[model samples]
Target: MFSLMYETPSSWVQDVEALGTLTLLSDHAHCELKAAATMQALVAKNPTCDSIVRTLPRFAMEELEHFEMVEALLRERGGKLAEQDTSPYADGLHKGSRANRKSLLLDRLILSHIIEARSAERFYLLSEHLQDRELAEFFGSLMPSESAHRIMFLRLAEGLFPAEDVQARTAELRQMEADLISNLPFEARIHSGPKQ
Candidate 1:
């Protein structure tokens, strides 16, 4: 059901969405690596507790693999990979989360869940409009994994905070995610773009 190719741009819209999709993938890889690094440092200091830190090293490796896969896909498509700058999509959402430091872990987990959920949504949308059979299939394949990440993050948020608190935080982050999607900063990218 996934293999599809459309010759007409009017029918596919992948010409526009492809750049955005690839850009988002590269950004995801970058952000995942950064997060993993942060967790590593935190874990080292804690040394015995934080289960997250213990698991993060493996997560980081997987993120690197994902980065390579996306990069290879970009190169195969003759699309240039671009460096990531601060995306307005992420910056605005982060600003709101950073402002409230009292519940930092809960905030971070909620925000992370929102980000993953939005990514799954975007991947689904892009897959529907993509033309290349291979590319379409790739995006189609990413949805379930991203959804799983979203759920994991949500569970973390729930553990960190009460149900009511988690719900409120999730709502706030979801709105931020919607805003980020509605207003993207900079033009779309392929894999890597020149530093902005």
Candidate 2:
């Protein structure tokens, strides 16, 4: 189970229903692309970090594959990827991270872990509740991969930083993530809260 302070309200499914499946699918595709890019960026930023170098590229490829799958789903629904505003949830998390060089990598890893954990949680919710059987099964299939990515980032953080540091920072960021999820207006976006 994800170690978080918040759980998405079941009413979020109603928001998704209002937003439409195509819209959600399009948003999901973008999330996948962003996830892939984030992994590659981490690699670029910390090239000498052996664990990151060895692990993240494979994760990046997996994210790209997920992107393709979501895009295909979007197209099948006659929806192309939509141009959208930056995710306030993700942006808030990054902004909340420590900016100093010493802590940046650890912070990024923790943020990635938080994101993946939330994604896994939401995907599981959608997999169970969505009326579209195909979409439900697709989301269900992704839950394990998302959960794996979450654990990988956490392990990487703990390996690179002191356990105390990792735990404290993860706790801090988890609170921030929970607050963001609780406050952000729900749209079709995967990380949003229920519509006001």
Which number leads on TM-score? 2
Clashes of each: 7, 0
Q: lDDT per residue, candidate 1, 73-183, as tens digits?
A: 767766555676765656676786765445766776776666666656556755776765676677778677667767766775675468998887666666655545444
Compared to the true structure, candidate 2 yields what TM-score?
0.95
Q: Which segments of candidate 2 are over 4 A away from where they belong?
A: 98-102
Which candidate has the top score in lDDT?
Answer: 2
**lDDT of candidate 2 over 1-196, digit per residue (tens):** 7888899876787679667988888889989999999999999999999999999999999999999999988898898999978899888787767543358788889999999999999999898888778888999999999999999999999999999999888888898888878888878888888677
Our model 2 lands, by Cα RMSD against the true structure, at 1.5
C-alpha local distance difference test of each model: 0.58, 0.89
Clashing pairs in 1: 81-191, 81-192, 81-193, 82-191, 82-192, 82-193, 83-193
